[model samples]
Target: MSIWQDQHVTVVVSGGIASYKAIYLVRQLMKQGATVRVTMTAHATEFVTPLTFQTLTQQPVFSDEFTMQDPKHVGHVALADWTDLMIMVPATANLIAKVANGIADDAATTTILATTAPKYVVPAMNSHMYANPATQRNLAQLQTDGLQVLTPATGMLAEGYVGRGRMPEPDEIVDWLTQTLIDQQTDLPLHGKKVLVTAGGTREMIDPVRYISNRSSGKMGYAMATVARELGAEVTLISTPTALTQPAGVQYIEVLSAAELLTQVTAKFATTDMLVMAAAVSDYRPVKAVDQKIKKQPGQTGLTLELTETADILKQLAAQKTGQFVIGFAAETQHLLANAEKKLAEKKLDMLVANDVSQPGVGFNGDTNQVTLLTPNSTPVTTNLLSKTEIAHSVLTAAINRGA
Candidate 1:
């Protein structure tokens, strides 16, 4: 069977010079056995006609909501329900902002806003426009909402400039979308296996207005999820609230505190094949959480607050392990290897990722990480600075090798 067999995809083309590429993407999806429906904005019609897309997709292109010719079939709601995956190729800045803000002024946006399916956005715009703070913020917000964002690459643009902002080629986009729809158990070394990945930093509430959290932004954990999906594992990510995009083919359970994390993890541990605890969970929380914001006293020299230890998530998970692969992360300053090895044995983890937070650009919120993969039986495998995506693939490979 094809990768996209029994799958339905909605390709939404926005207004841009890159709109023409959407047709090729549709054809590629069709080749992979996916049923595709096309939706285009008014300005998108300037470059390509509805007839052109209709002939390619073999489905009517939805342009306007009011143009529904039939009274019995609600077109917008029907299309929304039909879509299993939504990919917006050539997503312009205006379109990005609209989707980010939940604007549903047109057929494409309306269906997108209404659909409960996963959305993948491939942005294509001018280099400067792509890098604008407002656009970046919108992209981050979209990611935070669990939308998959494929970053624009650097290359020659239609505007005669060379930098980042070129839309990826149609075939590449198709491959990504195809991979996105494929079951995680197909052709993966870890096929028929279960994987648990934790990401972001938990927030420990002190008052209604304040909380304690670490510097972690959850990039590493998200990366691991992405890679694990690519390798054919059913992944469940326990994430703290963050702006990072959820990987395609992952089931995410969001938690705010260490206690919540413990509850979720323990509940899912029974059937899990491997557990990767990548979150920077808070070690302590305020003993008494103030229901209201704590008001500062005028004459107070310093505010004294009592704290209590949060649930030891990893240690507890380790105690109840049922021969499932367990992994942990050690973000340390001094005695890097020693600490990592200690954690590996003490927590009964199958492996631990040790990296010094003090090092520049190698820890939290950054794209690059230098990690040492510590195992119980052999020398640790250290890696140079690598993009989170690359590092994630390596880590998943290591885990699969070890587990197998």
Candidate 2:
């Protein structure tokens, strides 16, 4: 029901009679719109055939560490990268220890080691094995390393003697996985919403070589764009050239001057649900241009210059704002709130994010930022200095909560 639709989940099966439970796990995961793949340990294959799992998942089952089929490629890494989440249902005590350590003799172990995605382990073994000091230590280490471990349920086991080593039922595992995916989804709160973000400082060319531009490095704005995409928004980032890579999943439109950004923003205004005016646009441009790079004579110390007003894209967008939420950013040194409030109203914006650029380690090219979100209704919400990723989550959450 969420964006995990058609998401990839790899299920690793280990040696245990609880391996039968994986049949239903695959069924429930498929019912929830997930593309399921299975990998079995050598002993696990004794309980369930690779063909059986392949038939259930409608995908190939991988169980080999080395393959003569492709000597040049490692299938484990390929499977690892293909997975969004790696899950071990009926995780054996042996497998747990292997995962806790860096052992990678088996396909499952090797894939988990190579995979960068979030991993989860569903432990299923005998009560004695589950309570073993070694197992407990391994589990602790796995958790310390950020792995999600689902506790074994108390019930009957295949060995007929059990206290708390039974694998959780398939339905319950599905519910847990569903909740886990939902948590990941919230990181991108604006998912499915369209956002237009203008970033970086606009330059106004004075001559062939000389130009006027602000000290804005476009870091904050680029961070916002990265966060917006992470929060699931379809972001169109209109930016000036910077030493930053385009954020994945975001559509980037390069614009060197204020007029070009304005042109791109207007063209896509109707489709955007929110507009973040984070760009530091030049207020004016040279009224006249020279055919060649300006050269100073030995005695020349100054030159008279003429300037013309540049296009104000934020004001134009705010004026045409219908149901869209318009947010403007004020990077100020003094009278932050007063200037922010004034700009908020003058630009007809719904909200304004203000930051003290003069403060050290809080703005510009730095990776961290501290800012305040000012709403027209009340006082501003101050944010602590945080990594751009955290700030993006906070901003998107606030915007979504405001129903913007």
Candidate 3:
């Protein structure tokens, strides 16, 4: 299940030009399966209507504490008690001052004061105001009062100059929130574990411009890294060149070629508790790689190049394994189970994830995957076609179970 599934989140919007961005944040939270509620300051209403937020969240927007439509309970108190997490987006200077000074003058501040849930503050204002001693002091006070504050992004502001004090992008805010929530769960399956994951297809250079590589997009491996981090593992993602963003809170290392990947994984293997070999390292490389681009001869029909086998990284790691739980992936075009079982036994893998690349939407650059998990003595587990993220969770879950 997703970390945000069925979670209760309350978003407090204060006055600022960045208040409009709060709508995107709320929608993202909802997309992650969070039940979101909005509480806005009167000044915030000037920038965006309460009805807009109400329509988005499908819940009543709280703007005034005095207006009680529900006779059974106080609005602020009720909402505060219901909230599991509270986020103050575009937290204006005035709002920060009020909260820091215990001034519950509006519906937003009152509920913020009443809620016992963890508070995350994202401040947005002019660069000058953000750098001011008073604003900095209030932010410090929020921290001292046990609130988590996300650093504001620095960029072009509404005041017409490029500087600090831009509210972080919605995706960044959501990522931080997800990591924070995951970090809070001490009982997470992979908590306190160190995991190393390799991703993408390694490139074998044949010339200055030509190279040999696979169709692996690194999506599955990246997904594994993300899920592992969310499960409370300290993750190291060693990847080849890919267009994917690095997962938050992960140690990232970029490398090229099979030799570089081997060097990286070997160096970190001793300290790693779990090793996931998801990279598609090239099996062969040209025996002689030319420094300059190779040119075709006039009227030539073909070119011949000698090839040599690359290092067997999985076999090497398996042989050196002590207490580490090593997992390997098999991307096969034929004899899926038979080949996977042979590789699993040959490499002495603790677990193996196998997928038939010949099937459509099942492998190579796609967002979805259908995998079969194999272990030494257990029945092979086959999963239905699911997103890479879901597949990642399943793979990790199986690993954790095996390790336990």
Q: Which predicted model would earn the best lDDT?
A: 3
Across residues 25-83, which tens digit of lDDT does each residue of candidate 3 receive? 99999998999999999999999999999999999999999999699999999999999
Give one digit per residue, the lDDT tens place, for model 2 in 352-385: 8889988987777888889899887877999999
In angstroms, the error of model 3 at 391 is 0.4
Residue pairs clashing, model 2? 188-231, 191-232
Task: Judge candidate 2 at residue 390 and give its lDDT.
Answer: 66
RMSD of each: 15.2, 17.8, 1.1
- TM-score of predicted structure 2: 0.59
Q: What are the runs in model 1 whose C-alpha is more than 4 Å off?
A: 1-18, 21-176, 179-181
In model 1, pairs of residues that clash are none
TM-score of each: 0.61, 0.59, 0.98
TM-score of 3: 0.98
lDDT of 1 by residue, 145-261 (tens): 999999888999998979788999987786576566555336658777888999999999999889999999999999887677666778899999999766656899999999999
Candidate 1: residue 331 Cα off by (Å): 0.5
- C-alpha lDDT of candidate 1 relative to the true structure: 0.87
What does candidate 1 score on TM?
0.61
* Residue-level error in angstroms, candidate 1, position 65: 37
